[model samples]
Each structure stands twice: as C-alpha cells, then as structure tokens.
Target: MKSGEGRVCQNPWLNQGHTVEFSPDGKRLLVGSSGFDAVFEFDTDSGEVVWEWFAWDHGFDRSKLGHYVVRSEAKCKALEAMGHEVLLVDDPGKYEFGIPTRQKPAHLNSASYDSEGRILVTLFHQGAGYVVDRKTGDAQEVISGLINPHKLSRRKRGGYFISDTRRGKLIFIDENYRRTSEIALAGTPGIERSPQLSEYLQNTTELREELFACIDIHRSSLWLIDVKRRSYRGIKFPVEWSVHDVASLGRQHGLRIRGLVGTQFGKVAAFARQLKIIHHFSVDGCEVTALVLDSQDRQRQLDV
Candidate 1:
C-alpha cells in the first residue's frame, strides 16, 4: 500500500505465477503457476486455496514437466545432498533464478474461464491450448502445434483469440478448436514478441480516450494509436534499451515504461507526454519486474 511495501500472500503452490485473474464473481483468484505445472484458484477474502489442477493429474507424466515441483522441503533436501543449492518451493524468486531454463514443460502463460465455466489455458513450452473441467480437473488438449502460444481470451461473439508469439500471429479458433482466422502482427515491423515478455501493452478501459499503445523495443519508441481516426503518433525515448512494458498512472501521472538493457540491468522511465521524459530509475536484475497500476490506481513494481 505504501512505497516499496506490498502485501505478500505466501503459498507453496504459488510458484512462478504467470497469469492471475479474478473469477467472474470476483471472489476467487485464478492463477496459472507455470513452475508448478498447474492452475489454482484461491479465495480472495480468506486466501484459502479453492481448487488446483495439476498437469500430471490430468494425464501428464512427471518426466514431461518442469522440476520445480521438486523444490519441496524433502526434495530440496535431496537436491542439497547432491551439492545443489536449496531453494524453497514457496520462494518463486529462487525457482526462477536458481533453476535451469530446461525445467519447463507445461509452461502456462495464460489462464481464463470460458462461457461454459471451463478453464482454458495456453502452454507456451508445449505450444498448445487445453480445456479443463472446472469441477473435475479433467483436461483435454484442444489445440496443438502452435509456436509458443500465449494470452488466451474468449471472444465475445464466439470462439477465442490467442497470441502465437513465435509465429507473430493472433489466431482465432472456434469452439471446436478449429482455426477460424489469423492476424499477423503489424506496426512493430520485423520486431517479434518474446515468450520472456510477461507483461504486454494491450487494450484497456482505464484510458479516458479511445487510444491504443504499442511499444517498439528495437527502436525504443512508443506508438499511440487512435483507431477511429486511423491515425497514430510515434514518440521516441532517449534510451537505447528495449522497452518491455508500460503502465498508466492515471492521466495526471502519465505513462511508466519498464525496459532492460540486457539480462542483468533494467531501466524504468516516466513520460508526461510525447517525448517528454519526467523520471528514470535503474533496477537490479530479476526474472520479471513489471510496472503495474495498483488498487488505488498508483504505479507499482510487481515481480513475477
């Protein structure tokens, strides 16, 4: 709530959390914890786990998943016996930095509920989408052969939309998991989105105006678009680093941008308007530190 202060709800199952969203009733928090290879629902008021769906519980084999589950107390002890560092499974930061990159099989990037009250998730490493029964935890692979898919959202009209990052395509699929259409990403040109990019600049209702924002990491630029007018304005930043994500701290505070020079060092900038830079800060390396608008509509750094 205060500067540099946050509420920490520590849970062993909340490891490497990728996507978190509130249920339609706004009482349950659904999270797709990639490291655990599972999706979970937690009670918002009590912080109690309502349900969890593990990939292995639904036909997946332990040999095919990430070893993050092994970070439990007993397993960590065994790993320490082998001269490995002991990082608790409850500490996602350790699993993120201490573990190897190969520990991902059902690398879930997004999770949401469909109209039928079923769970839909996109597995980046598996390049597939799965439909899971909310009550039974029974899952079936609905779609596959995608190139590093992310962001699964149910369409208002019908079907769903998912971002195929590696292929630079926004694929639309029917209820039966058949491809209906695909849109090639434009504006950024040859610059492709990365699976490592957890936060994305997309459409939101917070803005007072009907405008869309797109960031060009390669050029260090931001494009403000007005679809109704078919016009856009490009604002360039003074930094050479790649801007990963942006957050709006209301109209009075302007936009905040988060970027990294490389793997270790990170940077954040505040822009008032156009090309005007108001503030900048340097950050220590983390797996992913995102600029987000908090409950009071204030800017805050969230590590995921």
Candidate 2:
C-alpha cells in the first residue's frame, strides 16, 4: 500500500475530518466533521464524493424543553445583572430561530447508523440524542439529559453504548432507550491492577466523585479509556492499548487506540497507537478519519 499518498478532498470547510465509518456493506464511507454541521458520504473503493447531509438543512427543532418562570421583575433584573442572558421562550415555540422556517442550530458531536439504517446523532450542547430516519428525514429524540455524550457504538445485541465524557461514565441503554448499566473507572480492572492508579482515582472523588473517560465493548469484553490516566485498558479483554477509543481491526486481530492528553501548554495532544504495533503516531492537525479492518491485515480509508 502507498503510505501518505491518497486522494484528498480540497474543500476548505471539509478539510479537517473528525471521524469516519464504513457502511455495513462496505460500499460507502460516512465522514463526520466535528467543526461543521454536516456528514459526508463517499465511495469506498474509488474515494469518490457521494452526498453531504447538512444538519441545518433539516427541520429538526434543537431547543431545550422547559421554561424559566420569573416570579418578579426584580429577580429577572438580578439575573441580568449577573451577565446571564435570559430568553423568555416557552417549549415547542422555543425551537424557532427568529425565522418562521429556520430551525435552531444543534451542535452535533457524533453520529451512527442503526440496524434499520436510521441515523442516530448526539448533540452536546442540548444534552440530548436523536434518531433520524434516512428514508423520511424525520428525526426524533431517543435519549436526553446526557452530559457531553461524545462517542457512540452499536451493540451486537440490540442497544447502544454512549460515552459521557463530562460525567466520566459509560451508559448502556436498552432498545427502549432506558439506561441499563453504568460503569465507572473507580473499581474497574485497569485501576484495580495498580495501587497508584487507584489512589489517583480516589483523589478525583473530591472533584467529580467518579472517573469515567471512554468505553468500548467487544465480543464479551469491555474496554475502558481513562482520560484522567491518559491510558487504555482492556478491563475485560486482558490486554492494554496505548490510548483509548479501541477499534477492533478484525476478529482476533489487534485493536487501534486513540486518546488525548493535555500538554504543558494546556492543549490536548491526540495520539494513535495500534495494539500489536509498539510505535504510535501523533496526529498533527488531523483527527482520526476512520479505523476499519478487512479480513486480511490491510486497513481502509474513508476520510481525507
């Protein structure tokens, strides 16, 4: 395979690709650009542009459901004095963005296609997740009240696994969208192995009370990515990746790990390391395009 030589998309707004995934049939590639509100589709083998879906083009309402009742004008003035902007909008009507037809902006973080081919997406700012039927373009809420849900993975069974970055917990929801189980980083395998690691996790209790970073579920094992520790562990796989976000290469094949660690300058450095390979690569300005494994040892690309 040619290293560092591939077809590149020259679109400026689409330059920084955040995440990518292959369709189940391996015919198309889905790309998610975090900085923008669109997901791109491309041909898998030929790297040809297919179509782009813009979230803003859809009519989905992206407002929080609730109302702030102000008992008196003095209390409202006190809130305004604290530099907090208050909007006196009610539910349902709150979704309008000053215009009659335009919908409010939703900051979409990650998205995935479910078994029925419907697209499910996570909205960070709204703390809610939605499922959009690709055939009808109708998006409906699936879950809500999540604190910074970042990565989403489909389970082999029938549900979904959501990564709550802010709360540091891996939430497993059933098909009915009810939270089934939540795994914290305190008593897991990786932290249990080292005493120092356990102490650090205990210290975080004064701050947040729980240490959950990232999580991935394989066949029968559960892998955890610890943002606080800047490490990856097969909490159930019995192996460790250098980072987190473990994407399996194939059945019995090793895993690909990606993680972020804060540097001295207070910026996060993104690192990618393969499980079998000892050396890892530091992503400069580029984020992970996609991590997919074929039946053979070769890996494919779905991002620029």
Candidate 3:
C-alpha cells in the first residue's frame, strides 16, 4: 500500500456542490451549488470558473441565499486569516449526504449543458427548471409548478424528461418546455396496495427507448416507467431499504443504483440497516451483484 495526497483546486464560492456535469468535449465542468444558489462552469484543466449564474440575480429571493452569496469570499478570507487550511467544509454529518434535509431556497440540485450553448438547471426548493445561456448567463424559466424537481435530462429520441420528485411523476417536456406527458410513479402498475402516497421519485435516467429507471422511495424500488406505453414495472430491491438514485450504465455496463441504506440478503433485513450497498443490475432489472460498504470503507459513492 502507498500513501498519497494532492491539491487539485479550491473555490470558496462553490458551496454545497450538489450536482456536476461535464461539457460534451470534457473541457469544462458545470456545478450546481445549492448553498450559494448559483450554477458555475469551471475549466477542467485550470480549475478556473469560466462562467457563472446566480439565482438571486434573476428572480430568487435574496433573503434565503444572501449570506452565502455575499459573504463567501469574506468568510473564506476570515478562515484563511485564522490559519485554516481548507475553506470549504466537507463533513458528511454537516452536509447530510443522501438526505434532503437542507431547506435552502433555490436549491440547485442538477445542472447540464443543453444544445446551442445553453445549460439546464433544476431547483428543488424553487420547484422550477431553467434554461440559461452559457455566454450571457441569462436564464429563462422553462418549466414551473413542479414539486422538488430532480434531474432534467434530454431524451435520446427527442424532447426532455424531468423527475418531479415530490409529485412522484416523470414529466416529459418538449423543446419549448411545454408539458407533453407525465407518468406517475406512485400510480404505476404492480402497486396493489392502497395509495399510501409515500412514493418520492428521485433521480431518473433514460434506460432505453421510452423506458426509464426511476428511484422510487416507497418500497425502495426502481420503477421502470415507459413513456410511450404509459406503463411501469417495479423492481423491488429488498436488500437496500432506501434507494436514492438510479442510472443506466449503458448496454455494456448495465444498471447501477446509488442506494442510501442497505441490509443483508435475508429475512432479518429489517434488523440490519447500517450498511451502504451499491447494487449492479442487468439491463433487464435483475440483480447482478451487490457490494456492501461498511463505515470503515469509502464514505461516499459518486452518483452515477
């Protein structure tokens, strides 16, 4: 074994970095910083911010994010004056990874580069999505009236898909951001139980065609929603009692789940819920293998 340490880049403005996206050419990194209520684009090589957009500059309330947005540099300078090595705090207990407890307004969770040098963003607290011009940092509200919108991704065929989390629906919108169709994960087929209304849809990724792998919190399962057919199939993952996000790793890599809680594969699963597991499933939704990570191992896994 060998020990290693290195310094890459540091930027005090990027607080609570929720979701990251890379440019198509892999030159720039787009970051959605919820704490600062801003989205930023950083050069991959130099680690310098090339473009930035602040929600408060648009229509976001300044009261919710003014502290972080205004005093970020001063706070970092104060910490530096105190001889502190790191400006940003990377504590799991402080940040509450995999939990949606932070209640900052304009909590930008996801950011991605869209066509024609425009970027897409989803603000969970604001319940809206925006399309921003990369050059001018001008934002246009594309979709609104959502409840805790998660990921807004462009479909391969056409149009776009958004995970309206609190509403437990996978919403599809056209290029103009008009609501075309939506599939309610809670009301999806195979759910015979009465509507407990516990379904919280999280990260959604296009699997193939119209099928999408959606993270449903009800049974900690993946609800494969078919957009065209308006149908769904629930793949019950009992090992992990709380699944957070799901993604298709492609036809070669299959499907991967970013789960929050997990237990052993047995009847006493309820008793053992301390483990964090990452399950790899086949494209067909069958469990391929499970890797359980204990506390001593890696503390966090990147959301795929």
Writing each residue's lDDT as its tens digit, candidate 1 over 60-120 gives 4223432333435776677668776443544554443222224544556667777777998
Question: Which structure among the candidates has the greatest lDDT?
Answer: 3
TM-score (all chains, Cα) for each model: 0.58, 0.51, 0.62
Each model's lDDT: 0.57, 0.47, 0.65
Tell me how far the alpha carbon of residue 299 in candidate 1 is from the true structure, in angstroms, after superposition: 29
Higher-ranked by lDDT: 2 or 3: 3
For model 2, the local distance difference test gives: 0.47
Q: After superposing candidate 1 on the true structure, give the runs of residues whose Cα lies further than 4 Å from its correct spot.
A: 1-8, 62-99, 186-304
Candidate 2 Cα misplacement greater than 4 A, ranges: 1-12, 59-104, 186-244, 250-304
| lDDT tens digits by residue: candidate 3, 1-304 | 1112221443565666666666878677788776667788887777788888876556653233333222255555665676653223333244333212242446677887788888888888778888888777777888989888887888878888898887788899998788988777656555422365555787788878888898776546777767679776778765334444454455333322223213232121211245566665554456666555445333444343
Model 3 clash pairs are: none
